[model samples]
Target: MARLPSGTAIELYESLDSTSLEAKRRAERGVAEPRWIVALAQTAGYGRRGRQWEQSIGDFAGTLLFAPEGASDNLGQLSFIVALALAQSLDEYLHEDQIRLKWPNDVMLNGAKCAGILLENLGQYLAIGIGVNLVNAPKGLAYPTTRLLDFIKDVPTPDSFCARLDHHFWALYRIWRQAGFGEIKERWLERAIGIGTEITVRLPNETLSGIFEGLDDSGALILRSDLGKRMITAGEVFFGPQP
Candidate 1:
């Protein structure tokens, strides 16, 4: 791969159960800041709520580790920060502004999920994990799925894509660190999927349906329900047909 941005290091793994797990382990073991682990294939990838990520034969999977100074308690904001970076990177290659974020860390395009992010905290460090549907997508998923080749005119190689993403991620991370979550929140809201729309949130014990208000500074989903405005920190969101 070409030279990546400063402060970012890349680690390639032929196969791993989960890049996020590996990165977290390294972070706990005192790995340096801004380390990234890219896996060509993941035998046991996982998504939010421990759901299987469904990595097929050919797909792009990776985890980016960042030991931001004084960021041990800001893991929640970091998750959105990384999602914003991925959305910005995808915007460069696609013409349509269809990239939108689903709550904490899923990226959707035209109502179909094209990518997802998983963040794991390692006390001193944070792992920003990402799994994108590149060459091939899984079968029989609950929702529609997409890949880069479907939107980009000329698809880039996996290495080239990773390099571009690394550059974008670093740029966004810098902005986030300097300006706080205000700017990131605004940008994220711009590409948010169901803001001001109606959606169903699936929680652990019960499901709630409400209007998708927006996200707070700390990256919680602001919902307007029959009871009142509720800040949801974790849940699965589904944009209803009527919004």
Candidate 2:
């Protein structure tokens, strides 16, 4: 609705299968400028590992398609950046203490998930897709979920919320582009959950349990285990005691 940051373009879809898919299509079509593709509704949205991401009509689903900087190895850091931005944008309504970020990109509200960030790495372009439960949350999910309206008296419309999100995202992005993830990592850790606590991380082949140490410089998870410390680049982390 409001003017986006300089040179940024946005496309609002009444309905789309997925914003990330549209991001890929735009990249393939030789669109190089930075853009935001937001879908008011998704027929078949997906999260990490292709898990279905359900979005109610009032929920938020959008992806920023842009050429990413840094080597492929370092691009994962952007997930933390996006998470930070999301948390900050929601900070306006939620109390400062109500927000916590799970490793990589999950935004926790009152110890439960209220938002998620999924990064789709296209060869030349990176799609930073974000979804937020602005008004209503799905039930029967594996994990606990909450919505912004439940906690705050006023819930922003999806358009205004995304505009606010754009403000925070670009501000943090500029810092990341200049100073790297050092500052970003610190802010993330401040809002991160499960730090210095026991958690389970499930990899493709095996699962491991360990103390949740702070992140490494490059943003790989620093996990301390009986076997010794390990660096995990990617995995699903579960907090609290695991059976």
C-alpha RMSD for every candidate: 2.3, 1.4
For residues 10-95, could you state the per-residue lDDT of candidate 1 as single tens digits?
77777888888788678767975576788887878898878898775446688877666655556688777777777877878874
Error at 70, model 2, angstroms: 2.5
Best by TM-score: 2
State model 2's lDDT.
Answer: 0.88
Residue 80 lDDT in candidate 2: 90
- Using lDDT, give the best candidate's number: 2
Candidate models: Cα lDDT each:
0.78, 0.88
Worst 10 residues of 1 by lDDT: 1-10
Segments of candidate 2 deviating more than 4 angstroms: 1-6
The regions of model 1 sitting more than 4 angstroms off are 1-3, 241-243
